[model samples]
Target chain A: MRRQVMDWLEERTGLETAVNHFLYEDIPASAGWHQVMGSVALFCFMIQILTGLLLAFNYAPTPGEAHSSVRYIMTEVTGGKLIRGLHHWGASMMIVVVVSHMVQVFLWGAHKKPREATWLVGIVLLLLTLGFGLTGYLLPWDNRAYWGTVVTTQIAAKSPGLGAQIERLLGSENGVGVVTFARFYTMHVMLLPLLTTLIVGVHIYLVRRHGIAPAPNDTAPKKKFFPGQVFKDTVAIFIAFCVLFALSVFLQAPLGRLADPTDTTYVPRPEWYFLFLFQTLKFFEGPLEVVGAHILPGLAIGALAMAPFIDRGQLRKVTQRTTAWGIALLAGAAWAGLTIAAMRSTPPETDMHAGLVDAPEWQSLSPEELAGLGHFRKQNCHACHVLGEKGKAIGPDLTASATKRDAAWHIAHFKSPAEVVPGSSMPPLTLPERQLNALAAFMLQLKPGSGASLDSAPDAVVNGAMVYQQQQCGICHQANGFGMKVGPALNGLASRRKRDWVVKHFYEPQMMVPGSTMPPYRLPKQQLQDLTTYLMELPARAPSRD
Target chain B: MLAEDSETSRRRFHLGVIYTLMGTIGAALGIPAAGYLLVPGSSNRKEEWVEVTNLEKLKAGEPEEIVFRRNRKDGWKILSEKTSAWVTKKPDGQVIAFAPSCTHLGCAFHYDEKHKNFLCPCHTSTFDLEGKPLEGPAPRALDRYQMKIEGGKILLGAVVKSQES
Candidate 1:
């Protein structure tokens, strides 16, 4: 594509091409293909820019507003998806084409001699382009994009000197905690695009001045860009657009869960093209870390900028520039490999005793979680945790438990455990004062159930209410037709089950329903008694006519 | 053909260069010029206090409805005939005007006898007699309007941004 463009611009250059081989001593026999590819990539980027701007007018960047705003675009904007979809695919294509451009440059040894300045400037353009792509990566504010950027910035802090400082400058210290999504969102839409366009002008200017490097082996008459290469370029671009359209229509980008700051399990990772650099930073863990993370990349760029000056060599053919090409190949491979490995890698297992309960699963629980066996037994926790061994093991066997999670993790897990620990047989616990402090402190320490007491007699009605929303029994079992139809109505369940059996059944509802959606709820002994006693004794709230 | 053609081309190129430079300068100055034109040409004229409620009609402690209007020269020049607001009269002749909207979530907070506080059913963020957060997550107190008594009725000042802290 670029060749087609250059062909049009330098149509007159070939006037003397047949006279002397001075312009391109090594224009390849198949130099035509390279021009075709560049033309394709240029059009893709323009699509991204245009779509991104249109989408910007409707997008909101704040943490609270991000998700709702996106919903509005999807449901409200007339053909908003076309605009958003293009912006999305455009970003993806930007990474794709930029990479393809780099590869073409690298494989051909276009970074040599007279083209050395061009090669260096092109490298800067690549980095700037990637930076633009990454900043835009978070604008949709989906859980994946938001967390992915957060995780990337943390890795960026490994850059030494300015790493931590820059992280703060990016607004982390200002308590970006939940707000960083909004901050990155604004930069992605408003700031980075503006900077990208300005720098793009410079990148293109330098390209025009130095001109494209010809392919590796030509000792004949050079071709004219206009009318000849231009036609070829247009044909190539048409093909590329056809491919882009196919991709946009056939493979829509998945919109992951909404931007959930509370979601710790969201493993942050950038788009695939960035995987190599992202992964490589992992090895820079200690003192040499700065070298791998920042210094090396910087030195590589510095070398690029200094290329025009370094090789005072008398050669014009990039085919002869072995050393520069070698360096470029190594840098590209390093980043690509590192990011790939990072994507494949998983964090090492943690210990429950380690005090670093930052484990993904554990973050959901508060200090008062009924994960303690005593609370669990009262809540009939093991009726499900014990799993195939029969009964409920409300709290899964604590054996090797800490390996999967951290302490703080327990906080997030407990909120609506169904959200965190979905299929486990444990019912969700909804406690009411029942020796609350004692249970929080001692229940976990006691065996599954040591018969914990309550603050008072069970208010069966309130306990029944708890059972409804907590078990999300309300979600499925419509007591009289309000809940999801997935489960049978619980309206008359209290009238059906016997007292002792009802008590035991309440211990673990899953025992009856083979594939129940309910999780292990470690209710305290009193609350358990309260709920069972309440449900068993209910006269159905006296059908009020009002 | 040598000297004459070269001389003409050079002159044309110089003139082109001059025109481009002048055009660039004009564009650079265009932004500020546009901004200047958008602003109001002069200072704001003094505003007159409008009558809100009858002084004798309002009783002590009991909030009375005050309705009035204001005339201004600038934006919204037509005299507004009437608007309603709550006014409290003091024995010494001080009148306080306040909006009925609650500060917390913007729902009107009614006095609850049992709780002895202004209760909000939404999340139960209770407020004190002065409409401050007594129980819930309200960041600020209810807004009180700036006002004064003139002739026989209370006059309300312009609404301004509140510094909740």
Candidate 2:
């Protein structure tokens, strides 16, 4: 029955013969493993298209919802993480395969004579692949992607005549916002994909027309493309997919905190493929940045496009084409060398905001101290002052400021910045007295390891109460006709749980209760003890009438 | 003739094995893709009544601010988020709860005893004791959450998005 259906369909559509002609080809026996890179690239692109379409169903492109939508996909949608991971890793794989394919084609002298148009088309494909990466990078709308795009568009703006216009077009008039996101999303999901697919069709047609370039010796036997070559390509694609699957399972695609345009502390870095260009910028300072950013790169691409014409050599063997091969090898080596050097020289981005938040120093802060830190961040003080590894060095480094000056000095400086430092550009703070005091306290606590020893004074209880209020611990734990009921009431905590256990729980709550949702305080050892002491003493107070 | 028939049968078996292997691979990929598409709609948050504070803590004709934490189960992750509400007891002893967010820009608004009004620091939006906007950028009254007194405890229901604000 299936054979009859197939025969009828074939007779009506003439599909069988057309498909046969499309699939079958003749090639040199010498076309071996190196010939498989193009097929592998195509395979990765197909994977990208499939996974990308799935992701697009759930992705929101607006600035407000992009990050949250991605978060939903990762945490709430089953197998969403796997699909996103494949798409993410597949992008890098595609670039790798395409670059290697280009390099192999170049070395084989396949771009010469009859295949110049094919070589140029391949170059355009390379650029389109890069375009895919650049546009897709911003779709996540995380801090890394936002800031990386900012730097790239700024680089684009360094062009001589139409620089500013390009910047304004890439970035909206008000800067990266709804308009910018919409533009990038359209290019990433629609324009670039359509353009790439069309170009790929043309590229394949050219390859079929020219056929695979034979080895220089021309002594190998001919082979049909169906069983031998197609099998090799299939194996290469399967191996590529296996590698991508393993990577996706083990290494999750990074999703940094949501994009905050106001956050200038974030250090922007591009993906590894662009590291060579990024490192090149460091050598060319202010005025000459355009040279490294645009001119040099443009010249390199121009040279590559003109290579076939410049050489015009009939020799395809590497031994006979010493000059061309040497130049290519040197360029490749330079890029690889620069990439390694950049990787080693630049500190890891993970350490950029360390010791500020999500670090031991931040967790150890008292409630009042934390409030002061919040005020500092809200006021954008980091834009000028250097705080730990964060912030630029435009103002004094505040890491050791506490050791050099007292709280009173900080208060005075905040009230009158120009009086404290001659010709200071900092504006005088006009916060309420309580907030100013909190800010001063926070600044004074910035000394290295200053809060390590919590002195148990006669007023330790009052300070502990302030810590409780600052941390908003009452939000979960109820006490004295106050607080919420999320956790157990602490009205008589001294009688309920052991003091030792309470102190240990503060350090690591999971150690006490495996499934407890209470986050670890991660406070200093002495502060933990003080908090436990305060909890133990809660029952001493008489119950207040409602 | 018998040898020829056996050879053809062996070839048929090999072809069948290849077809099965291909089908297995396709199913392995297609199942996850289908699951990913369907799972998000099934994984939705179900509202439950959560205890905010004891009714005894509130006094007649006075508003008290209460902050709490709630756990949101999103697929495999249980995320704890801090939430706050302003609880007020009327002269007749009826309870009311207003969400802490301002109507203008969603900033957390706090009651200022000195000013005798709820104020949002972000845009200086102000609301009265009855959760009505008094002045500034607030477009309407503060949003309210459904509440009830259960077993001497104040229970807050799902937050209702105010259409007016």
Candidate 3:
């Protein structure tokens, strides 16, 4: 029944003859493990395409959402992390396999005679694979990706006359933004893939036409590809995939913190494959930067592409290609040396792990104080003012700012810097009152040796107490067994009424209690809330005093 | 005839071993890949109750701010984040806490003694004494924290992330 179906289909489509002809090629029995690299590369590419397509279904291209979307895929989506891991590791595996395949082809002198086109196409494929790595590296939109792209684009911008144009093309006129992300996304997912597939198709066709290059000894028997070569290819591919799978499981892909353009602390380094190029840039400075950044690499690639014509030896043996082999070995050694040097200069992964571990001092900060610290960093306050280990001493040290000045004073200083400190060069800040207060709260907690303190004044309550003092609520109300006997004693007010009631009473004193002598404070909503927060907590404080 | 039969059986045994090895390798690759695909789905966000401050140290009408560390395990990495909250003791001995984030654009709001209100410096949003939004662009009052008083200490629950407006 199956034979009849196959015959029927073949009669209609002529598929059986075409497939038989395509699969029945003869290869040299000497074609051994070395020939399997190409098939392994092809296997890795197929995996990349499958996993990349799955990832694209979830990835967002926009700068604002890209990182968060990747986080969602890694942490939330089903099997998303696994698919992402495969794709990530597949890229590295493809590069390794492709490089090994190229080296094999070069060493065996397979680029000789009529196979010049195949060799040239292979070089282009090598570059396109690297291009794939470069473009995909930034799609995660994390700190590492962002800064790596930044460094590369800056290198591109050093190419003399054409440098500016390249920079503008890669980075938008305003810098890396929506335009850059969209362009990279399109190239990574659409254009590069389509172009790679086309070149790969031509490459495979050429391989088929030329057949596997004969071994230099030329003594081995020729064998059919169906069982012999096919089985070997299958075995190599399965083993390669097993390695990739183990890597994906054990060494899960890293997802760094979300990209922050303003962050200056993060150290940026390119992916491992690009470390050689990145290290090359450090050697050339100022006027000669182009030599390392562009000219050298360009010349190397040119030499590789022109190898077939340049090395016109009719013999296809390793001994005959001594000059070519020497040059390849020298280039390989240089790349390995540079990559190792770059790896050593950078902080080790252990340092990054240590950074990820929480410090004990962090837990001592109140929520407001923590936010204030974030504001301090975000506002670039460290540029002038010294605070602990961070910031410069151009301005006065803020370690004791809280003891020196009250929350009200800090708020006033932030609004008008020069007014607070006569002749102060500090720029006036336009932050809202809330941020100013949070900043003040953070500053207050920065006393010397205060890191050991387990107890911290809650920022809201401190601010609330400040509000009570500033509003002179003590003039009419008594609290904690102090102040006048007029109105209700706020010390136990929270016990009798909820926070909302107190807030409403502040807004309209007559609404909650009839004919009350307490005048409406006409305070803002947040102030009322703060005052109420303070009033509500007053009872809790009273018991402690007792 | 017996010699030929033995030769054929030896070849068959070798072929069987090769095929079995290939199958075992295939399974070794396939099983883990399948497990990795299911990892994201099975993973859960870890939350823990962290100590904020001691209750005896909180004075009446005075709010004390405290920060606690929380660790989130993401695959092979543990991310430690410091979270802060405003803790206060009421006159009746009831303890209350609020997240430091303002209901507005999440700028930390602080007490303004001169204005007698909680003020967001970013947009000038004001909240009255009760943590109610009195003015500005804040959509609601400050978010409150889940609190537990135990063993002479105040422990704060996982921060209640306010829904983005």
Candidate 4:
């Protein structure tokens, strides 16, 4: 019955004939493992489309909600970590596969004669892949994404006469803000995808028209592609999938602190693929920055696009293509060298990621000190000064402020910044004496390695925060502005229950709150106590505005 | 044979006409889309004076970093952005406000009290109190904001690029 149905469908649409044409074509006998990269790349692209569409369902494109939405995906969605991880790793995998395909094509002199158009289209696809990377990176709206884009726009703004115009077009007139986010989202999910899909169709058509490039001086008879080359391609694709899946499961994608427009301290570094270009910019300073920014890169792309035309020799052997080989070798070495140099020169501090709020020692602070922390936030002190790992590092880090200055000095410096320390960029802070005293006290307590345990106050509250983060309670319950709203807001939990009751609730969530989606947090006694104390203190502590 | 050649020439001409029609349609759709994308980013921003601080608050010959918020239209959103400038009240009562970004690569420059110069930490680019590039990779003097003293309040306008060294 199935065979009869298939025959009927084939009679109407010629679907079976088309399948036969596609699957049973005569491939060059030389096309074995070497030709599998193209199929592998196509497989990765399919994965991207599937995963990207899944991501688009939940991803909020606006600047305000993009970070939170990404966090929502990572923490709240079912199998979100795996899904997002696959998408993240898949991007790099796609780039790797696509580049390998390109390299294989280049080395084999496959981009010659009738296949020149195919090579050209392949270059466009390669660029579109990179375009996908560039646009997709900003969707998370994290610190790295924000700063990396700033660097990108700045680089664009340096391109000779049309620099500012290009920057504005890429970002916006005012700078990277709402428009930039929308622009990138549109490009990533809409424009680029559409263009890439259409171009890829043309690319495949050309590839099919030309068939696979034969080996240099190949004498082997052509063979059917059905079982031999198809099997090799399938194996390669399966292996690629395994590697991608393993990476997705093991190494979760990083979500840095949210983007801060006022942050000038962030050292923006591009993704690894663009590191060579980033390093090259450092060499060409000031007037010649245009060379590194646009001119040289432009020339290279131009040369690559015109490669088939430039190297018109019929010979396919590497030995015969001396000039091409020489140029390609030098360029490859230089790119690798620059990328390595960039990697080596990157500062170690870029890896330092900290929670958005609350340092470890905050738990040990007096009420006055806690109030001072509030004052610090209210004053927007983080715009310039870094506390713990949070905030910009434009000014001296406040983590070791106590070791550097006495409370009296700090107070004096706050009152008359330039007078206390000449050439100080700190503006004159004219606060009431009480607030100043609280701020000074707060600063005095900030010593390096001053853990919450060091002080007598129930600083275990900070330790409780650590427990909360480690336990991933934020995935379900939100306190203040952090975490999702899947469960009840923990803002006024103390009002809802006593400490003992809260601790009991943690141990038996379903028992306390029937139909609670949250599973019981099987934490140690000390952790429960700390967590309860943190909840108890939540009422007194004001909700974070940011 | 001659009649056949004429027929082939007519066919080629028709194909050329078809391509030109297609090209015209493409341009009609494409040009506007390109403009739509580019125009928003490339619009000339109008400069307006915004009150920064009271003139009395700034000490003479000393630079004070003044932070203020400006409501700027960014695409569909009107966002209030926090921006700052290094304002120096000259001994002669001439208030000069330097753009916070350094002339070299736009990193935030801090006024170094010990060196009595503006220094950018990124490349160690230094500028004197007069905004002249004194040391390092700064290609020009520090750019200054156009300022007008209205009554007792110091208002800053557009940033004016300084002459390159």
| TM-score of each model, in listed order | 0.46, 0.60, 0.57, 0.54
Q: Pick the DockQ winner.
A: 2
Q: What's the ranking of the predictions by TM-score, best on top?
A: 2, 3, 4, 1
DockQ of each: 0.02, 0.13, 0.09, 0.01
Tens digit of lDDT per residue, candidate 3, span B3-24? 9998678656645655775687
Question: Candidate order by DockQ, highest to lowest?
Answer: 2, 3, 1, 4
Query: Which lDDT tens digits does candidate 1 get at residues A352-380?
Result: 11221112221122213322323444666
Cα lDDT tens digits, model 4, A502-522, are 888888989988998888887
Per-residue C-alpha lDDT of model 2 across residues A154-261, encoded as one tens digit per residue: 777778788989878777556677888888899899998999999999999898899888778877778677655665676677678778888887887777767777
Point out the higher-scoring one by lDDT: 1 or 4.
4
Q: What tens-digit string does per-residue lDDT give for candidate 4 at B31-150?
A: 533443343332233444566788899999889999976546443234557899999998999889999999889999999999888999999999998999988999999999998875
Model 4 chain A: lowest-lDDT 10 consecutive positions: A351-360
TM-score of predicted structure 4: 0.54
Most TM-score-accurate candidate: 2
Q: What does candidate 3's lDDT look like per residue over A1-546, in tens digits? A: 999999999999999998888767888777776788998888788888978877776677888778766776776676676777888999999999999999888888888877899999999999999989988988988778888887766777777689878877786556677788888888899999999999999999999889888877787678766555666777788788878878877876777766777766678998898899889989999878889998999998998888889877676566677876887799899999999999999886432222222233433344355557656766898787645444554565454345577889888888897898899988888877777786788777666434323123344655565567567666777665555667666665766788777777777878888898888888777767766775676542122111
State fnat for each of the candidate structures.
Answer: 0.00, 0.25, 0.20, 0.00
**Full-model lDDT for every candidate:** 0.54, 0.75, 0.73, 0.75
